[model samples]
Target: MVTAAFPYRLYLVIAAEACAGRDLLAVAEAAVRGGVDLVQLREKQVDEPTFLARAERLAERLSCYSVPLLINDNLRVARRVGAAGLHVGNHDLPPTQVRAQWPGVGLLGYSLEYTAQLHTPEAEAADYLGISPVFRTPTKTDTVTEWGLAGVRAIRAATPKPLVAIGNIHAGNAGPVLQAGADCLAVVSAICQAPDPERAAAVLRNQIDLYC
Candidate 1:
């Protein structure tokens, strides 16, 4: 929970698979240089050893910028590396379990699509909520109904936790999401797949500030 106290800045998380063998540090550095508030290491297909190693490196690199580094799914690696937080999906580990394992590390995030999930006790325990697939997104392996700005607005109105609009949110549509009340934006291809990630991040940050 490195930046837990200052969560207003746009949370830019880059989800890169370890299998792709991409240079995560370079990508992360560019993002941070462009005012990204947070970075999450999301490597789903990799083995434990490889995932831990990469997460460790990312955590170290982010330390310089005081950028919060989060881990997806693995609480052990998160706890070991002192990650800023952890992001858990519907099928992944529960937020309560993560809190129990690492009580000192209070920042834990959860994924939500349907508004009903936000009413649950577990959702209340999480630090933030990542409401996704505002448009059709290939990144979501699960079935995602397009929860447009209206849906995102509903989530923002319903939850006290800060909202992070994810999946298909980019420079073009980011304004509406923030207007809908999103505190942050989580993007993958919008930044990672961009020709110039640094500039892409700045554009997204500008949009975020505009709407904020």
Candidate 2:
């Protein structure tokens, strides 16, 4: 069995969505300035060449800030760009497989919503868990699970890994998520779509601190 690795660690991560129209690299830079500790690059429609280019640029930009840049669903790009990690879903390769392929590389996070999966042995090997749909969100239209504050707590109690609450999490709900035992909030539309991304990120950081 794949044993647990990364210790539980609290962190603020910025999730880049496919639906967001803005430039992700620029937004990532702004988020780092606003104290974001991690950034996930997730693009569904973009081709390999285009995705690689963008990921490379983003990696370069993030290098100076010491932020962990993780590619969602693409281990190749994560390897190529020298990213800090990769976040994969249930359908993707398991964290154990990822660790086998990239032996000494960085983290490998899994997306977990259900309590059962969160407590599974494979989940213990994950560097972190992205517990999603905290509130009603248009971003995850196909995903129906809405793991509210109660769900967040349930998942946290099941695993020692740091929990990152995503989907519909914004400035307003950030405090409650932390209070519910989430180590951080993974924001997508709230920061990527905001008129002032830096300001929005600042507000999220402030709220997390205030509630802590």
Candidate 3:
């Protein structure tokens, strides 16, 4: 069970390609400056070495601000970089196995692709639950459930773990998601591809403060 209150308000899920040609580190730094509290490095197309290098650099940079970095489905990189945590989906390493493998892991997140997953051991083992694709988006095509506003409300009623709502979330829609019971907002293009990541992040952060 999660022992403390969920502290993050605006979460950033970033990838090198998502930055729209800007330097990944620069974009991340700008986002943090604008109020992104938590970050996750999700590199699906990159090789292990590339992923590791990115994670290492990100871990080093984020450490300066005391912000936590969570690696998405990359246990080795996460462990090697001494990241604050790991976020895994249904196909990746299970949360129970991750706990057994890395007992000292400070935070563990599990993505709920289906509502049924909320009742599984994985959900029980997670420090937070990612309500993925709260709306369908090009970034995540493999996910099955859309988990629209109603879905978010239903999941919120069912689980007490902090909900991190992701997929196509931007400042315009952030307020309703938080009102629907999400504890945090996770975004990809909203910040990564924005004309000004800092301003984008700040806008989203303001929504969180205003709504939640």
Best candidate (score: lDDT) = 3
Better of 1 and 2 by TM-score: 1
- The whole-model lDDT of each prediction reads 0.78, 0.75, 0.92
Q: State model 3's lDDT.
A: 0.92
**lDDT of model number 2:** 0.75
- Using TM-score as the yardstick, the better of models 1 and 3 is 3
Tell me the tens digit of each residue's lDDT in model 2 across 1-212: 01244332224344445326666777778777875767888776678888898889888888888777888888899999998889887778888788888886588788875677866766876877888678878776655578888898787677677777788888887778888888777877777787877787788888877865
**Top model number, TM-score:** 3
lDDT of 1 at 43: 80
What are the clashing pairs of model 1?
none
- Better structure of 1 and 2 per lDDT: 1
Clashing pairs in 3: none
- Per-residue CA lDDT of candidate 1, range 85-189, in tens? 898988888888777777876578888867788878779778888886777787776845678888887877786778777888789988888788777888887
Tell me the alpha-carbon RMSD of every candidate.
2.6, 3.8, 1.7
Q: Cα lDDT of model 1 overall? A: 0.78
Measured with C-alpha atoms, the lDDT of residue 21 in candidate 1 is 51
Candidate 3 lDDT over residue span 74-98, tens digit each: 8999999999999999899999999
> Pairing residues by index, what is the TM-score of model 1?
0.92
Worst 10 residues of 2 by lDDT: 1-10
Error of 3 at 102 (Å): 0.5
